[model samples]
Target: MIDSQLSRAEDPELAVQVQRLHQLKVCTRWLGVIISWLVVIPFVTWQLQEEIALMRDHFTLAAVRYALIFNPISAIAISWCLGLTTAVLLWQSGNILFGFSSRYRHQLEKQVRRIRRRGKSHVFWRWVIGSKNQ
Candidate 1:
């Protein structure tokens, strides 16, 4: 599935993401894991105290966007917006980072292919074996 170039600095394929590299299914699975851990967990554990804490934290901003002056429904709504915003931010930045790394992988792939084409196979094999040392 890994059709992109990977850098020597950090080939996820060479490490944690090795087996799952370049697979849409892997992304989906990972996203599902994150959502379960982050969104569902806290939501399920939610209580009235936590809701009040949320209202207290955003008390200043409420004056501007809301006028009802704090209720259970408003507290829940504010907390949800905060959680959703954090998730969306993470997703967007993660996407950008992956896009950049994919490009880097493509560049590395081209470089490797170029060397393989121009350099003799025996030479490459010798280099891999560390010359006389190995």
Candidate 2:
């Protein structure tokens, strides 16, 4: 997408808008990742502590085994869920606040339509670009 946008860099106005949108997207994505990790680390730690405490008396290989196996999986799932949710929310809020070019809006609406076609079962269906219906 950036590549396609850059190709139109000859148009100064478009170039600037694309640059601004790109920067916003990048910042929001990283912020989402950081927020996800911040939440996941402590939550996962507390979960592990609680599980270990509960199994302290009858501590067996199975408890440790399951923790080792499931913790990472759960952590990854939770992180992706939180990260994507945060990113989408932040992106939409930014769009509402700053607005975007018609080209960008069209692209976003196209993406939202594709996601919507995937049905409500799609992970991002709920947050699929807010400007879509507009």
Candidate 3:
């Protein structure tokens, strides 16, 4: 299905824009996922409870203590994820700041503006489908 979308996108100009936007969106999602894991993983590890039937019972939870204590795990996890996020954000920040840097972003914004005015599905279709050749 994705191959089809990429192939379809290759055929037109709009498709290229969609593909790039898709790429950007994917990067964004990955950043979120990696960050979440960074927090959750070491968290379970620090509390020394990676697996269990139940994470919490009536009145005790290691997760709570791990989070509250002066453990480096939390700091490390947050730092790791944040460090990566920061790197990515720093890398992309220039593009976001310049907006003018990538003609693609410009084109994307143009498409958005046009779509708002014309209200046509074809606009979206083309933006996404144009990427196959790309």
**Predictions in order: lDDT:** 0.47, 0.62, 0.55
Which digits, one per residue and each the tens of the lDDT, describe model 3 over residues 8-43? 466454455555555655577676868677667766
TM-score of each: 0.25, 0.40, 0.34
| Candidate 3 lowest-lDDT run of ten | 50-59
Worst 10 residues of 2 by lDDT: 125-134
Candidate 1 vs 2: which has more lDDT: 2
What is candidate 2's lDDT per residue for 17-72, written digit by digit as tens? 44444555567677777777787767766768866785787788888767767778
Q: Cα RMSDs of all predictions?
A: 13.2, 11.0, 12.5
Pairs of colliding residues, candidate 1: 5-105, 5-106, 6-105, 13-18
Error of 2 at 116 (Å): 26
The positional error of residue 10 in candidate 2, measured at the CA in angstroms, is 7.9
Q: What does candidate 1 score on TM?
A: 0.25
Clashes of each: 4, 0, 18
Cα distance off (Å), candidate 3, residue 53: 26
**Error at 86, model 2, angstroms:** 15
